[model samples]
Target: MATSAATPHNKIIGQRELVVIVALLMSLNALAIDAMLPALGQMAAELNVQDGNRRQLVVAVYLLANGLGCLLPGSLADRFGRRPVLFVSLAAYAACSLLIAAIHSFEVLLALRGIQGVLCAGLMVVPTAIIRDQYEGDKMARLMSLVSAVFITVPVIAPSLGQGVLLFAGWRWIFILFAVVAAVTGLWVWLRLPETLHPENRQRVELPVVLRNMRTGLLNRGAIGYVLGAGLLVGAVFGYVNSAQQLLGEHFGVGEWFPLVFGGTAAMMAVSNIVNSRIVERFGARRVSHAGVLTFIVVSAAQVWAAHYRPGELAVFLPLMATNLMLLGFLGANFGSIAMQPFARIAGAASSVQTFCRMFGAAVVGLLIGQAYDGSARPFAHALLMCSVSALVLVLFSEKGRLFRRLNPPRQQQPAGPPPV
Candidate 1:
């Protein structure tokens, strides 16, 4: 419930407003991805895409570019401030959305999506930096969970929104809607959002300084380990998303009910975020997330067995997938907060590096898993199990062979990295 202080311009950014605005900002990315799900079949048909897996590149290429794009914005935000970086990125993202709507060639569409991903990178990294600016540890996790609760709602509805657009108009209208949403969000930030980066903490935007700051962020033992661990879990989700249309709509024969089915599973994730927000402070992030991860592994193993034995069974498939999404709800914010606990002084650079690691690694993992789809859930289920196992190993390394520990020791206890300014 901590509110941001009045800006120099006297705009009062209350906690509620901040959380809502931040969630909306993050939702732009989710909307872009999720709203495209129902339209993938149409898009591939119109574009003459012959390979089923290649259509997934629409999502995969954006994700890969988005990860690479994460590398620059943090250093820029650290130098220029969060508001400017976010505003410019939003403007450009909107433009890319419009450009995507107009492109006729599939190659041009993917290139535009790649550029849009790069622009949207700021949208992903900067709000996170803003959150890290205001809070840390479990409080940060709590607020992030709240933000996630709202942000996740996009996934719950965006497929339906896309389906609606497709019913009335062409699939391109989805991008037009994306443009409109981004423009509105960008204007709101330009006018109301304050400079959260303290004036003194701003660094010079130079290669040496940027590199040093990035190195500090990337080299931290705990942060890097958690970043990789969390990235794997997230990558597993991306793999599912990439193949969801095919698996749910075509293979499962859900057809037009696909949006509702996808949204239902996503709604479970939103519910999980709400529950995590409620309990995270009391239980501490590590214990809650650790339990979630272990539970996820067990569930993933069940998923593998079910998929191998009963690939066509929706009753078994839907609930297990929904449970995994719910488990991710517990893991994402907690892992991110733990990873970010050490970087109070260099929140922007650190956030950027951490985001880059997670997004880039997840993108690569998602691409591989998505392309491995063979008209069955086996690949997706196996990928989930592999990802969870790998994540557990990384988390153990990060905690020095421990699991389910409480809050990480404070910055002074860390072996490396700058203390809070």
Candidate 2:
């Protein structure tokens, strides 16, 4: 568990290769979700979905499955080793993508998409455990921010990519692309990526032990508080993502330009993440996260006010929404890294727990916001404002009401104590 010892274990991949692989693996989740944004209407029309609200299910179901299914990968990775678990999950993900393309039934597509989402959970959990395997505290935050900066490119390009594919090809071709990407990535990983989970660190595959570790992670105030807090904060992003196509196309009448608007917002997030990777090392995760959340709250509040007065205007709405998302990039990576600080010894299960909490919580928030679509941006903006305030409260409570304080420094052995209740 020494940072000194972890250095060598992590060095095999080298920094640049490690970043690239981790970014791609992590982006699988984003790519799968975002790439289908432009085609949601087309998909629904082709599939004969008359209710507009139900169309968002194409996005929501995947997230729901992702949250529920993430429960397995961490425990399995801790037991089996990262490489094998990853390969299996990636193969399943690829298979699902391939299979979904040929299936025409909407109900069946959702079911298969759920299965694919579950498979994608492995893509989500293992890389974090591997990163936790290498770094801790602020350094881990920095690395995660960088990974996110790289990973955000998927969101930036995926909708546009989806739009591009839809130009000459049917929507089902999107899944074909997913199949191709997953297969190629699976091969690349199998051939190039070595197992990062060390033999000495492997845990016995036992349900009771997994539950106990998850309980411990939940009971730890810093971990659980941030888990809930960051999860709620992340819910704002998911809410926007789920409703983005409609909010742009229906409310703002951007229609075919929805991908461009969405991509531009995502690009801002990428820039902020790049900046976050640089500044988090110096400011510490706590200070940066605290400031970031406050910024998120202010932006959310302003968005609500702006949407109230300029509700129908595209010019005003897009910039504020983009700014809010850009600021969110600073919060997500650091919050997760901070939450994982207490779980070095059990990063697999801990990562699973965190992913579950974040994704499920986000799913609930997103579903509500998406369902509340009233042909205006107010519902989304109001949801953002509410989630931002809720997140700030949970984060404040997690820190025992002390903002901008770092309780654990990078590479330091964590002191044992009960967290603030």
Candidate 3:
């Protein structure tokens, strides 16, 4: 409820409009990956990709590139402006997507995918930085939740879109679709998005200064904890993503219907995001995130146990997987807001470092899980359980064992002297 007028330094545009645009921007990352799921096999076949495992490179490489790209453009945005960086990056992303669609060799495809990831760095970091430019505390959390709520719809629809493209036009058309969407988004961003990083508030692009700020941000106890926790949470989600199709199609025999099933579960997470948006202001981000993480831990552990006993039961598997993903919707927005809370002066750098850690962590975890794919769901379940527990421990330690303490402190306890008297 802190009005923009109170902080002249931070100009608030239309919050609702900004949230929608940022959400669309963030959805691009998910769309890039999710929309390729149904086409992975076809892409591999068409490109004569030798290694079956290497086919995942199309997705993994993109994510790794995205993480690496986060390092520089964030600083550039702080120096230049958010809108310019964002528009340029989106255009580059569109070019990469088009290149990927037209490429015949796997090498070229991999390189294009990686470049796409790198270009998306602007899309990933700038919108969050812009939100930080204008809002903080619960307001930031609320806006992020709204953004997440909007983004949740991407996963729900992307797979279906991919499948439709595959059914009609073939897999290359998937990348073409990505290119078209990126082009449209780029134009919209150029025309509609204003410069969020004001001229007066711009920081000079000093390498030493950027490094120093990054170091400081990383060293902050709360920021580090939230970053690591967010990373672990995302890593688990990525692990699930890298393995979900195989688990469903090959193991459970879901076949071409896999996309519908996947999209349905994603809709469950979307519902969780909507709920988070409603209650985040009153219940507090820390409480919601901590609760969600714990719920994730519990569900993941149960999944491990159940999978051990009945490894092939889709009934046992799918529902638990959906629930865990829903929990992530609660964790994602809150973790970012929590990490950025203590670093206001250098919000851009803080956002960058935090994003870098999350993506890097997720890439590592996803790669590890991807390697463990042995035509069973056991490895994925095990990784999820381990990650959830690790994240829970980190969150608890980060908040000084007060992870769920009320954001609004309780009234002071009366002295015990009255009882003695």
Candidate 4:
């Protein structure tokens, strides 16, 4: 509900418009990954890829690059401005997409995907910085929940969008579409979005300065611990993403109906975000996310049991996978806010570090789990179960052995992080 008081007269923009733009910006990465799920088969075929599991690199590589890519943007955003950084990054993304479309070698294709992901870092880091610039505390949490609600739609539909594109055009055109969309978004950003980084707050974009700020952000145990903990929780979802196509289409026999099945599972994440947005103010983020993590552990245990003793058909697989992903919504919406909450001064750099840890860690975890795929759900289920257990351990450490307590809560000015349960 906050408004831009700096805007002239009747043209003031507020939370609603900010929510839409931020959500769209955040959606770029989700769309980039999800839309490619349906095309993994065709991409493997066209490129002469021999192994089905290796094809997962098409998703994993991009994500890995995206995480490592965050290192520079946060420092840059803090110094130059969010707008220019976004513009240049989007332009680079478009160019990389075009370059990727023409590349024939698998190695070269992966190289370009890495570069594209690096460019996509702007879209990922800047908007969260923008949100932090505008709001704080529980208000920030509530607004993020709303942004996530809208952003989740991208995953719910991206596979279908990619499938429709695949129906007529080849897989290469998918990258071409990436080029086109980035160009349009770049223009929109250039024209409408104002610079969120205030002049007085701008720091010099130098290596020493950047490192010092990054070190400051890293020193906060509350932030650092939560970043590592949440990464493990979300990493389980990334593992599923790495194998979604093979698991749903080939192993379970969903075939052309793959998008619908994928989207249905993803829709739960969106619904959870909406529900979180509704009740986060009343119940506090720590309490709800803790419950979600507990639920995730239970589901993960059931999945491991089912996969080991007797792997079920698609009917059994769908609900278990879908429910686990849904739990991620509670973690995602709150965890980011938690990590960024205490370091408002270095929001951009802090955001980058926290996000980098989560993504890089999750990418490694997902890559391992994906490589372990044996045309069965055992690897994925086992990975999730282990991750959920690890997540609990992390949650304890992050909160100093807390489980459900919300010490001081977020609405009131209180301690740095959650209290012990």
Could you estimate the TM-score for every candidate?
0.96, 0.94, 0.92, 0.93
Tell me which of candidates 2 and 3 scores higher on TM-score.
2
Model 2 whole-model lDDT (C-alpha atoms)? 0.84
lDDT of 1 by residue, 1-421 (tens): 3223324475657888898899999889889899999999899999999899999999999999999899999988887788888888898889999999998999999999999998789988999999988888999999999999999999999999999999999989999999999988977887877778776567777677677778878777787778999999999999989999998988888999999999999898899999999999999999999999999999999999999898899999999999999999999999999988888767888889899999999999999999999998989999999999999999888888898778555862221233323
Off by over 4 Å in 1: 1-8, 412-421
The candidate, 1 or 4, that scores higher on lDDT is 1
lDDT for each candidate structure = 0.88, 0.84, 0.80, 0.80
lDDT of each residue in 282-401, candidate 4, tens digit only: 888888888888899999898988787766488787898889888888888787777677766677777777778888788888888888889899999988989888877877777888
> How many clashes show up per model?
0, 0, 0, 1
Distance (Å) between predicted and true CA of 118, model 4? Answer: 1.6
Largest lDDT belongs to which candidate? Answer: 1
| Per-residue lDDT value at 420 in model 1 | 25
User: Which sequence of candidate numbers ranks them by lDDT, best first?
Assistant: 1, 2, 4, 3
| Candidate 3: count of backbone clashes, pairs at least 3 residues apart or interchain | 0
lDDT of model 3 at position 400: 82
Q: 259, model 3: CA deviation in Å?
A: 0.7
Which residue pairs come into collision in candidate 4? 402-421
Scored by lDDT, model 3 comes in at 0.80
Better of 2 and 4 by lDDT: 2
* Model 4: residue 267 alpha-carbon error in angstroms: 0.7
Q: Each prediction's Cα RMSD?
A: 2.2, 3.7, 7.6, 4.4
